[model samples]
Target: MAKPKSGAKKATPVGKTGAKPAAKKDKSSRLDLIKNASKRVATTTTKVVKAAGDAPAKGSKSAAKKAAPEAEQPKEKVSEKTAEKASTKKSAAKAAPAAKTATAKTAPAAKAATGAKASSGKSGSKAAAAPAVPAVEKPRPRATKLPPPGEPLTKREMEQLLTAGEGRGVMGEGSLKGRLVVLNEMPNLVVVGRDKRELTFLLQGPDQEVLPAYVNHKVSVSGMIRKTTNHGGVVDVRKYSAKKPEAEVVEAPPADTEPRLRYLSPGEVSMVTAAGMGAGIKGFAAVRGNLEMTGEEFVLVVSNGGTRQQVSFIIDGKAAAKGLRKNVGHTLQVMGVVDKTSGWGGRISAENVEPRPSEARAVSRDEMELVHIEGEVPTSVDVKLNHGLTVRLPEQPGFTWAIEPTVAKRVGLREANFEPGPNGGPATREFFFTPRNPGTFEVEFFLAKALAPGLVDRSFKINVTVKP
Candidate 1:
């Protein structure tokens, strides 16, 4: 036969020289294959050995003998290419478990890692992976960022803005611009800027776990304001101080005609806070409330605001500036008997006023909207100013002692008069009147009873009737 082609099978070698190339090549390759297979198997065997204290795998020796008997089989049948492919398939099938095992090993190691090295590793991994998500949104804005208090406002500015009343300090948050301090250790820090327009701020620090603490005195604080789901935003406090000194007054039990009065009796200042809550001193919403005294003087300061106002009452028939603190901010409950006084600022008087129990304070976003009534209110007097007829007006119940004339001649009015009402006290005057004509007209009655800075400055209208 012709010499076999180079690409074809080699001829059987009979001599030792040729034996080196064919026999040695086959044996070495066989050994290499066994070595490679042993290595691959070692991966699994190593795990078993480590777990069981390095003992030989059960039946491994028997399996080795069985594999040796298969060596005589044509090695070409189990070619390297075929073995490699099988190994690759086996590896692919065990991929998940192999990775999991690696991770299992790493878990304990990862937990044991210490120092910034470990932390940095975790953070770096998180940072890299987290950035992969491209759709995370940003938070919305509430108000303009404000400089944290103490960081900005000087002590002098704070003192100048919030000092004792009576021209001593700028009018309560109305006049000047100063730092808004959300005080701690007061009754409640819900003190709104008192007005809508205020400084911009956002609550900066608050793990937001606990609320700030407040006690019975009016405290001052400075902080960063933040908007909260709460009607108003919460304040992040920085510095605070309680500012309730004391007052002059005596406390006695309530009188006979008064409502259920506690903590307050006669000759004491009744802190009228609400509009119509008729009750005792405890009626104070008790937010930042305290019963303090100063040498024969008793005072009840409110965290919401100072109770009892001072109004100028017609005491002793003299225009004296008196401090009147009664029935302010109340709707339903009328204050105590009006008493005149002297040595007070502006027009003021004292009355037995209590905390308003009925009126609920407006929260942050509540409708503080006011509905202005257009229709005129009926007063005790109905004046007709027409045909040049001026009549003396009749008196009313509370305003019997008329201080001004109530007669005039105008378009639809003919005449009017004023008379006294029931139980006119020494300081109060009451009156009632009649109109001679028929027409719509406006009137004013200075009840000589004013709790606010402005006296009984209410509006009244009269619909006069023409004589039939």
Candidate 2:
């Protein structure tokens, strides 16, 4: 370093003292140039940010233009190529935010696809990788329509009705038109539905009275039916009407053909007893009655409107036994001949035995005998054949009256009427029966006490003789 002279212009080193005024002025100008350039950049960056904020979530081209805002180049000027490069860098930066926003907008759709698989019990990674499609369901089978009412049921149709269950339109609901063939006139009406097939049925309600008049005649029957075992069932007849004769002959066989054996009425069979057994009685008799089986013996106790009688029969070996077991509560037709010593009583040889359709009505009070029974019972009581036997029982508390099962089986439960007593102790019970056969029966009456549980109170025995 050299020492400077005083009062003379010192040759000061450039770094030793402060810079020159002209040099300072040039520096200030350079600084002002830089400041202006920075201000322009800041203003352009603010404009770009404002444009991006105002744009939709899916952004617009305006945002991109604002991102590379051409900062008015400093008045000092710059190369065109360099300005283009700077603009490109700013454009890339702004495009990056738009791409991020687009990705964010599509995030819900991607998450929905992933969630579908995840709900289907798949792992998160697998759910995110693949998706599933929904499935469709199958339809059900259709139903079948019923056969025409006027036509007869074929073998297949009959079998279908026989084996039909709920929902099978086999014995389809609604009215059925057919020829009514009455088989028996007894405690209940029994008849055959003679359409394409002979369907046996028990007549019920007011229709029972209506059918007896039109036996062996063509008619239209309306009712509800519930299927039973075998090919037969019972009809709950609601209404019935007589069909025209032309309708009956529509499917009728040849006129010269031998007709089916006609069943006899209850009154006709009872008239047989007055005529007695003889050579002329060898003809077929269609008698209606209750069929009872005791060991090897088969007996029928027939009932007339005014009387009842017993008729024994020999079973035909050639007869079909398809529905024989279900005929206990049914009225049956015994087509046979009358003889003296065929069974325990007067016997009739049964050529054909089957369930018969009939119109059953209750016995009138005029044909009944009222007998009051109390503490003591007589040794024997006389009951006229076919006449109603009404036994009046006294009302007592905690006591019930019943006949023995065997006696009830031989006779019948018939009808029991219960009426309220004067002081409401219990009830006055009236039991009725019409003796069919001429025999001495030991009827056991049981007085059951409520306190004894299973034990019976007092048992009274009585001998009843049905007159010939």
Candidate 3:
């Protein structure tokens, strides 16, 4: 046999040639497959490494197991080459899980960072959507500009101003009447009405300059008015006038004709007499009598020329002040209204008193020998014959003073007059007596009721000496 080529198989024996050729052919095909697989292993290893790197973390372990079998098959065919490749594949398979683990760990960090960014973005959006706070505004004072001096404001203008300044102040035209005064160093007008309702207004305008002169005087003004506050306002006076209070006038009672007379009833008489003289009567009459003033009041003794009975008349103080005292002892004609009347005497509110010529001579109070005693008296009293003794005692109601008949015959009671107490206090009764003869007698005075004379409220006994 010739020398065999390295790549070709040796010639086989003639009887075994067929089997040898078949075996040679089988070996040659196997070599070709090994060559092809060697080439594919490199490509597949690259593919497996890439797939391992790309696989998810959950599938990494299964992908490494499948690559291990593929690497082992190549290792059996070519131990040297496949062993190196197998180790490479095994390392890649091992690195696949490590890479997956690293990716898994890094994934949460990236997600957390991304979530933080998203939350920050959401907060920024909320801040942008929120409403901004508004700034507070301060209150401004009302404008006090006045209208030009001319005709009063028109009705429409006044209404508009009032409506605009409802809670504040407004200026308009109106009239006011009140007393002008200075309050709080500012001139103001005060109006006091019925039921204690009062309104005050501050004064403004040119007329306000003269407000001091019109203090306490009634003032009437017409001009623009401005209300600065709810309680009061201001007045821009255009025209104003002040007036002083007038004096009151009193007219005297009419002294025309004398008033008509009304007689007193019996009950009225008793009451008047008990209160003593100077009591008021409800009538008017005219009489001519002698005017005599008993220091307390004026008495008109009407003798009627000694023919008629003597009657006493108490003259009103006001009438007596009207020149009636000038004719104290003269006969006078008195014409006036009668206030009090009784069977014995009465009171006169004289309207006029004039002297009248008469034949009967009137005795004057100064010319008569009269003795006056008041309050307490001595146990013994002396009186001249044909002289008058006047005794005044406190007047008690429902009582009268009386003397014994024997004492009365000697010392006669001329008359009894009543003098009203000062300032409406208790009254007094005056008893006048004239002695008829010279004698020393015990005189008893008793204050008792007219109907029941025995019931005496008081009594007094005095020894009286009558001298010639």
Candidate 4:
């Protein structure tokens, strides 16, 4: 015990000052630990209170307290570090609910904003989204009226209606009315406008049968107007109304005579042209007239005695003798077959010809020299050379007859003398000549207006022969 080692515990002295000071130091430390623990527990409690205020229903507060009781019992042996860790965990859990609540509240605003943008797209575009509107229509103007019926269209009117181009509708399309003349019966029906400038038509449809009853008579015809190469109108008839003739001629002929072999009138020939010739007609086709050579055919010009209705017959061959060209004015009877095959209307294929019987009498040369043939004449005649020849001219009404003086001088014949028939009737003329030689001579006879001074007339050329 002399001197205790420095590292060993030493005994305390029983002094009042030393003991009081030691005890006081110990108390101060205790109080300081209590204060620190109290501060930590207060901080934890503040966090728990705030979490409950923010999200009381998110989790159970009792469970949080049971799991960590560091704040409830500050006297426990738990470490400061442990208490701090538990408080941190509680704060984290509480903060998680707060963050979720904030996120849930903000999500609806974001969704609402997105919906607004989508709705604007559907209704905002103008041209692409709008409905369509309908358009209104305009009306047209009417057309002008056509010309009156039965009236001949003027040159200007015709020019306006017709065209030089081919086809039926060249004369624009329309209806027309005019006088009808049926040119033929059944099978092929043809008609024409007698007063409407003789506009020809080709009759068709159910109304065609009614047209034959109106032949050579006046009637009103209605149909569609068309054109042809003949410059005549063609109608597709729909209806017709006939005006009865003033007089009707009914002729009953001998029985059993064939149609072709019977004599045909001028009107019949015209009908044949309109209807067309079926097969062939054979019989004597006789005509009395002066002969004329036209192209490769001979034309016989005739005038019916009573009516003076003129007609022409086309012959196929030449009928000229060596000196007969000068006798072309002399009348002769030509007999042959009349058929439609050769020429326009009808043709006479002459088989033989001779002077008319009344003019065929032979005269003695002495009597011919003494006779002064004048005033009127026999219808036709023949003569001998070195003797005078007398010709008889017929009465031709509604006509002024004449002969060329130059022709008489050229043929060595005396000038002709004319004698008119009684009471505004026909007129006649005679031709006489002393033949100096044997030959044929031709003469031209013409018809002209009574007072007209010009060559506006139709002529007949005849051939005469002087026998030796």
Candidate 5:
């Protein structure tokens, strides 16, 4: 059997969009773990550490009463107020895992220190000692030896080169010069020159003398040439000193030919990327945002002040990355090749774009049409629209006093829809719909509009048919 045709009204389009699939947001891995843990805790929550009034952690008791040989007043441990305090100890332990092993390895010393600190209550001593702790600065990966070459290399960088040399087993031989590029960050110094030759050398001592140089500095070098298919070509950089480079001027588009897009105001014009206009011509400006470049042809937005309209048009060539940015904003000017968007065909193109001064005042309009009328319109009555919108036929243009009913005694004329006359004058139209059916019937528009701020209608009616 044939399936019944769906009576559901077709969804009107906005910005050429269909009933888009509901977007499915990806679940964050971190948030997922947190949520799972939270859920588990919510179901099988354990000990609830209720917050007591703020006070020193674990309040002191009166030296433990001497009942039945009170245990020797246990020594108190030092408290670390913040998380940072533990980091120092943790780093120290990790640095020498073989020696620290476990808490048992140094518990005695730690316990003794805690006792001494607590007994003395010399908090200032601990604070002073903290400054002495060699702030083991984490090794930063800095591209070493970059300057006009006179200044010495930075400290951490010197250490890195020596460490690299030790790994390479060639400490002094690795002379860095020419177009220096870092390859690896660890073990040894593996770099390539401007010409693309590999240099794997090691640092014998902790010094900046082993690092490389770059910038507006030039160097003279003579070394074995090396080349690769995938990577490129280069000469082994060896034996060279830094020298200054000469200056030169750069070329650009002709001054007059170099046109720029000047948006009349701080607003945007956004067209669908598929609108067919990509980057316009290379030298000129892009097509106006009102034009819709598409796989087929470009449609332009043309509006005659009173009632005409601007339409989307397709011109061959690329379009700019600009268009109407805001849903309601107007396009002022366009220039250059408009790039065709990805997945969008490169067929339609805009040569150049310039926003017409008249384009300055673009507006969003709501076009509504009545499709059906429910119930009856009694003499001297007003109908409420489906969406609770209050609309009357005379309120719109080009339509007025069109419908005539036999049962209705009198029809009111409260509104009128008028347009511009073809001969350059104002045009007016009227419609007066009177009903005799005393039932349900629908009133529909003869045609539909294809433009901005689509009309939103929810049926209109007078409730004379339903029982009161």
Candidate 6:
């Protein structure tokens, strides 16, 4: 070689440099390699973005590292231009997680929108598959009209009237005649018409206070009447009057019908006793007393004018004896012939034995003259013989009235009775007497215990004269 130009450098021998200087890479070829690496980085970044959205967020950095290696491999062989492109690819790989975050945020909203459309479509299909139903009609009730006030009610109308108005009674104005009676402690009227049909009315008015006095008497009442039931009603009495019912008259039988057996009169009985039939009296007498068994005979203990007398009964048959035994301790009336064969004590051959209606018959106030004496009397009180005299006084518990034996003989005690006080008050005792003989005598009474007559609580005395 000629002498080199001034700017020209000489080439080193290959053997002396040990190795030929590496051939300078072509810029275009290096550019091509960098571009290809950029393409691979972009593809890998796209794959990483897709995987980051499906996989966990921690894998994003690892994906970036893998793509970095591909971008850095080209840097060793590339020029400045290749380095710049590789830097761009690395930036894109890092941005993939951000893009994946944005995709995750919008996913739930898109899914909800799709589910709404599917549910609406399903509801529409179900509604079209169902069937329709028809509605039913109901019946209405008719109204009833009442008849005029003055017109008479027909049988059908009467039945309807009774069944229709319950609790609210039908009003009317009429007069009714009935017998006033007391039922359930309330005054009610019972009416029996010509057909003998009875109708009861519960009386409710100002006259209710006086209705009790008219009980069991015929009454005529007129006012506003309310029919509560078919057979009963309520009466608001404006005017009322009560009357006593007339007594029914029974005709006597003919005199020749039959001769009835008659009992002995008081005068005839006394005459027969005064005749002195010692052997056996041929007369019938009725004796009333409590039957008692003495020895083998049944004796009737009779209380006559405060004097007790025993009359033995001669029972005829076993049936009569059994019947009289059942009546022991009970007051009985025995009617038979008197046999005076046992001296003064007479025995009755019983013809019939019957129980008395009551232990003691009630004496009528109109049949006898009554004389009332109370407390103590110094002067003699005149009284008619055989008339009743009553001594009334306040009673004491556990004490009884005792009379002198001599005074009791002359003034025989008929009965001793007790009258209960009204409204739970103190009670009173009454001693009834009839003078057996006409004489002036002093009657003394002591209120004392029956077992101890000497211990007296109180005493009363009275002088009485009986006129024949």
State each model's C-alpha RMSD to the native: 20.9, 21.4, 26.2, 23.9, 45.4, 28.3
Backbone Cα, N, C clashes tallied per candidate: 79, 11, 6, 16, 73, 0
* Predicted structure with the largest lDDT when compared to the true one: 3
List the global CA lDDT of all models.
0.33, 0.50, 0.60, 0.48, 0.31, 0.58
Please list the residue runs of candidate 1 whose C-alpha ends up more than 4 Å from where it truly belongs after superposition.
1-203, 206-220, 223-389, 393-468
TM-score between model 6 and native: 0.24
Residue 32, candidate 6: C-alpha displacement in angstroms: 99
User: On a 0 to 1 TM-score scale, where does candidate 3 land against the true structure?
Assistant: 0.25
Model 3, range 1-468, lDDT digits (tens) per residue?
A: 568669787656778555766667755555564556545555555555455445543344465457557655653554444344432444344434543454445444434444555566668889899967788876433323445554555665444333422323655677778888897656788865322356578777665556778788899877777657544577777788899856769977679866556655554434433423334556545667666544446777663111112345678845678456556556787777655454435677788877887544223345568777776464777888878787887756545456654566667665555555566466676667787788887877777643244567878777778889
Q: Rank the candidates by TM-score, best first.
A: 2, 3, 6, 1, 4, 5
- Candidate 3, position 406, lDDT: 53
* Pairs of residues at least 3 apart in sequence or in different chains that clash in candidate 3: 277-418, 281-339, 281-340, 282-339, 283-338, 284-338
- Model 5, residue 170: what's the lDDT? 19
- Once fitted onto the true fold, the runs of candidate 2 whose alpha carbons sit more than 4 angstroms away are 1-18, 53-62, 65-287, 290-468
lDDT digits (tens) for residues 354-382 of candidate 5 = 55543321212235222233222332233
lDDT of 6: 0.58
lDDT of 6 by residue, 1-468 (tens): 588879778877777784523323443454466466555545655564554444433454455446446544543434445445553455444434444453344344333444455466668778888756577665332212222234333454433323422324556666678899988666788877322456777776667767878988999987666667766677777789999988979989898896454555564344333322233444567766665443345655443221221123343433357556566556777777654443223566677888976555455556888999764443467889888888876655544455655666678776655444456464565678888688887877777542234567877678888899
**Against the true structure, what is each candidate's TM-score?**
0.24, 0.25, 0.25, 0.21, 0.18, 0.24
Candidate with the larger TM-score of 2 and 6: 2
Residue 179 lDDT in candidate 1: 35
Worst 10 residues of 5 by lDDT: 70-79
lDDT of model 3, residue 344: 39
Candidate 3's C-alpha runs over 4 A off are 1-284, 290-320, 328-331, 339-341, 356-375, 381-409, 412-434, 437-440, 444-460, 465-468
**Candidate 1 lDDT for residue 264:** 33
Ranking the candidates on lDDT from highest down gives 3, 6, 2, 4, 1, 5
Which of the two candidates, 5 or 6, achieves a greater lDDT against the reference?
6
* Cα error of candidate 2 at position 304, Å: 14
